[model samples]
Target: MTPGRVIAGPGGGIPWDLPRDRAHFRAYTSGKWMLVGRKTYEEMEGWFGNRTPLILTRDPSFVAPVPSHRVVGSIFEAIELAKRNGIGELVISGGAEVYETALPYADRLVLTTVETEIESDIHFPECRDPENWTAIHREVWPSDEENDFEIILQILDRKSR
Candidate 1:
């Protein structure tokens, strides 16, 4: 979340602008296995080619696109699948619940803080503590014709246990 703690507007609408999309792609989405909640996956249509999708849901009969995606009942199952597939970098592309579930174990957070005040129904977890996390990368993107607000991309790494 940005200083305002807004991630999505009502009905899962995105609050960030276009430049943030590209920044997000470079920072978190490319060449990674993304663990997403069922609603999140559904919102995304299916899966994108750059990253594999692991859908996490409690619905036992939930199905995902064949040969490319799969559904997991728990985060443990998702991690185990990542291990089996030899995925070193995993992305938790979230809808609120999944982010909260993975927050404690997440090693890094790639956040694009948009400088704007907007109402939102879903908020990113306020679990980041300045004392325990370090910002390793920071880039500021100014608003242009295509973007409404300035965006700051920060990659935060949790301090060693």
Candidate 2:
């Protein structure tokens, strides 16, 4: 996401490329159960190495291309699937709707805010309410030859009930 919370540009793809941010995303989500919308799952085709993905879609006829992947009808179904598989944590990686649906159930949010803002059609759901979350970790990375913009990576944990 950018400073403006833009996740994807008008082209329906990430507008910026930050190698460090990509690396961080890969490291953090490796071997984890990831929940994503169908469009996001399609966009990320062939990217899943050892990670399991639960793709959320309203279409009951939709089938995941990968044998290891599962198609779920909703966020709750995805969570249930993960739990049934003995997964203790599920990473919500999204394309707006999925983020919005899962935000309330999230225990932690891992976000990367790109320093610059650009025209975007897709935005991340707002979940920065101080009453609901507390920043647990934050790190800033400067722009380099491989990355066009500086990025601020943050991990916010949901406030205990």
Candidate 3:
């Protein structure tokens, strides 16, 4: 979740560099990692350690490497498992569907709105305006590479009910 910044990864706008240097990288995530899929969770292994992971999957073939992960039958099941396990912070990663299902429960959303709309087969969850949420901050940054457009990082917080 490391700071939970989301990105669309297309077009031109501003620019920012990815920090390959470990010393400068700031991790902004805590609590049990409740990832939405086996693949998505596995890809982020570098960011996880002793933190337990809740993986949502009905596929019998999906096997996680450690006992720290619990495979669930459905998205709702994973949410229940996360709550039962006392997880306060969660990040909804891709496989697309997972993000759609988990967005309802996220209190904080970090979105990267790209300038160029690269047509993808999949899209992130469509979040317009919910009664409980509002954009708290939106800052622009340059794309990591040359010719790529700028991207906007948005932080949305849940307005108190």
Candidate 4:
């Protein structure tokens, strides 16, 4: 999932018009299993219909809307479940807390640098340490009438430690 460059807006959530980002999001997530935080899952409304969802929440009594979806209490449990299901490449989509939790283990990150800066309480963690990350791909999207902000999409791969 693509987090805003500033992570989120003043409301502590992403609040911007980004059609191109939406397109990019669909392109990557379509027909894939998504590992998402509970809050993030709740924020979505009828979106991501094509993907399987694994919701991570600390509440053991939590229930999922669909029977096909699974809920786990910890990231470790999620990882274990993903492994048992033979999920080869895991994608950790997030809320800031979950992003921070997954940072050390994340093999790759799809970062979309939103051009315009806006106030935000939540922020994406800095991953610029050359020893840990290396940019594998980069593309710049200019702003347009449809999307009010320009964005730079970058793919970062974690270096073998």
lDDT of 1 by residue, 106-144 (tens): 899888788888777588888756689999999998988
Instruction: State each model's CA lDDT, in order.
Output: 0.81, 0.88, 0.59, 0.80
Candidate 2 achieves a global lDDT of 0.88
For candidate 2, lDDT tens digit of each residue in 1-161?
88788899888987887888889999999999999999999999999899999998999999889888989998888888888989999999998988888888888989898999788769888765768788999998999899999998899888885
Query: For candidate 3, lDDT tens digit of each residue in 1-161?
Result: 11222332324211234442121222444444656566566656566665566777768787777766677777777767777878766666554667777777678876655555443345566665566788898877665654255656678898863
Residue pairs clashing, model 4: none
Best by TM-score: 2
Model 1 bad stretches (over 4 Å): none
Sort by lDDT, best first: 2, 1, 4, 3
Q: State in Å the error of residue 159, model 3.
A: 3.2
TM-score each candidate.
0.91, 0.96, 0.67, 0.91
Candidate 4 lDDT tens digits, 112-132: 888776767677776656577
In model 2, what lDDT does residue 30 have?
A: 96
Candidate 2 minimal-lDDT segment of 10 residues: 121-130
**Model 2: residues with Cα > 4 Å off, grouped in runs:** none
* TM-score for predicted model 4 compared with the true structure: 0.91
